[model samples]
Target: MTIRLTVNRERWWNHVVGVADEVDGLIPVVKGNGYGFGRAGLAIAASKLSPLLAVGTVHEIVGLPDEVTPVVLTPTWRPPDTTEPVLTVGSNDHIAALRGWQGRVIVKLSSGMQRYGGNIDLVAAAQRAGLRTVGVAIHPPLAGTDDDHRQQIVDHLPDIDPSLDVWVSHLFPSTYESLPDSHRYKLRLGTYLWHGDREALHLEADVIDTREVRPGDRAGYHLTEVPGAGTLVMIGAGTANGVAPLSDGRSPFHHRRQRMALLESPHMHTSMGFVPAGDPCPRPGDWVDLQRPLIHTAVDELRWI
Candidate 1:
């Protein structure tokens, strides 16, 4: 039993290189399951594009190739145990925490997202401490348009030193190119880089078991009644594999180009989905298409074709 991600290697690699060529200074983000390719794999792939890579935290810095320099995106109050990766400082407290460290740091500026980041003044404050201020980071909210994000970055330019590099996220390629070239800009991209060519990627899970059920038949852990006389297809993906119902509560499993109904909530390592009486159903050894997002899923195998 397995959940697998199949990739068209040629198309996927072409898209990766294409994005690298289009973006001026692309800092490939290799964090949080590496957008489904896994972090180690992304780090290796990112090495071919840029020397610098951005990760979600210091802990993700491990297992990276020596050629790639990692920068931690999350703000940390305590200094990282290793000074290898550059750290992000968003507040005075964060800056003060690493006052004596001689490593590089990126000062995060507050933006529309309001998730993490400090005022522009934090840049100078980090320099005042013993840390080497390498760049300034701006993570704009995803809710706004590219123009809005560009304006937000422009609005902070006067206060930030022009010499320091500007790292930004959530901007379209055209919008990023529209920014002033006088200042250096590095776009931290993850989703756009890896998932740009969705047609090159596919996800599927194996049918581990199946059972014939009648309408009103009690089944599953909670003894939920069967909705109709159909075949109960037990899928190999479940909560353990980040397989859950869609946000709207629809089943994430699909068969024969039709969405299957969930028999009940997903359990540890399997989910039960029902195929209607007259609909096409998958046998125990067959595979079913899964509709869950790759970033949120854990696949048993990754096959590159």
Candidate 2:
């Protein structure tokens, strides 16, 4: 039983390089399962583009190569276990927590997202506390247009110290370019950087078992009667593998380019899908495409073709 992510190596690399060329000071975000490529793999990939990388938390700062410098995106109340990665401080309390510590820190300014950040004064507070202030981070909300995101960053620039580099998220290249060129700006990108070329990545799960079922025959965990006469195909991905029903209650499994129906909710390591009698039914050794967002799915194997 296997779940795989097959990459069109040439196209994927080309896209990565192109994005790097297009965006100046690109800091690839290698956090949260590395946007489906796993954190370690992405850290190495990020090193090729830029020396800096961003992780969600200090806990995710492990196993990275020496060439890559990690910047923690989330502000923490306690000191990080290591001093190599740059920390983010959003509040005076966050700054106070690092008192007497000699490490670099980024001041997170509050944006429309209102997720994590403090007033622009936190930058001076951090500097007063004798911490090495590296940059200012602005994470825009996803609810607005690119112009809205750009405006949010622009709103804070006059107050932020001109010497500090500004790290921003969720802005297009054109929007990024529109920012005042007097200050250095680094674009912290994840989804747009890795998954931009959707056609270059493919996700699939292997069919592990198959059984012909008749209508009204009991099946699945609840032992509910089979909905129709079809082939019950067991796939190798389940909740343990990050395979779950979509928010809309639609099945994520597909065979022969057609969506397959789930016999029941996914189990720990497998999901039972149904294919009507006239439809294309996969055999035990066949592979089926999964219509899941790569960010949310975990695969057992990665194949770069």
Candidate 3:
């Protein structure tokens, strides 16, 4: 069965170009289903708009065509053959290991993100190795830190390298835009383009089949029972297709919207759930929201047409 997804293609392309222009030269991130637009579609779009290509890892490099300079956010395990890369330095030791290697590279400095990057000392080592250091980098915290992350980096940046060719990182647009033009080097954007700039993107899946359930009938795993006399509509797509809707209380990303509960009947790999908002909500062969509206949901299945 096929679950149809509506593509806001014009809005997407316009956003990509708009976002890229917001910064000096955008590094279009084309990793992992191109953040929902499909890698090929994103790569082609990014190639046309961005000065450099942004990708999650080395594996994603295969799809990009020539003329696009690719930047791999992954630490330097191997430099891909497609394009010369500014290898991401995640640790001080990795910088040491990269010492004596002559190539274009970016030092990934870690902060509240606490994920990937090197530090000030790593910069000195790179200079010593004769590596053409084009950028100072930091992947910002997911919480979107209140100036702490960038401030910390800015405090240390002068001491690291005052002549950085590029200062690459991700940040909320407010933060990114506030960056003094002199200090801001490059912006790596993903969510803003493939997804929406704000809490506006929507994802929907097709309703497949609906069944009437008696008040006490058992359903799915653990012998869960149907609570009322209502219709259970089977969505065309399920968890196997990455349509499993979910939420947790710890963060605002989840608390703001509703997610479909999991269903186990048919012993499925993908997921489809009985809509809590049934009848008036969705009809079989009709499209229904599979993810929280306005909240950034991870990409599951995406096909751009």
Assess every candidate by TM-score.
0.98, 0.97, 0.80
TM-score head-to-head 1 vs 3, winner: 1
- Expressed as tens digits, the lDDT of each residue in 220-247 for candidate 3 is 6566776565656566554444443444
Pairs of colliding residues, candidate 1 = none
Collision count for each candidate, in order = 0, 0, 8
Sliding window of 10 residues with minimal summed lDDT for model 1 = 75-84
lDDT of 1: 0.90
> RMSD, model 3, all Cα superposed?
4.4
Question: Weakest 10 consecutive residues, lDDT, candidate 3?
Answer: 247-256
Clash pairs of candidate 2?
A: none
For candidate 1, write residues 157-204 as lDDT tens digits: 887788999999999888999998678999999889999999999999
Model 2 RMSD in angstroms: 1.2
Local error of candidate 1 at 182, Å?
A: 3.5
Indicate the TM-score of model 1.
Answer: 0.98
Candidate 2 per-residue C-alpha lDDT over 50-132 given as tens digits, one digit per residue, 9 for 90 to 100: 89988999888888889988898887777766678899998898999999878899999999877779888898899999999
Error of 2 at 78 (Å): 2.9
For residue 223, what is the lDDT in candidate 1? 97
Query: Runs in model 3 with CA error above 4 Å?
Result: 81-83, 96-102, 144-146, 181-184, 197-202, 249-272, 275-283, 292-305
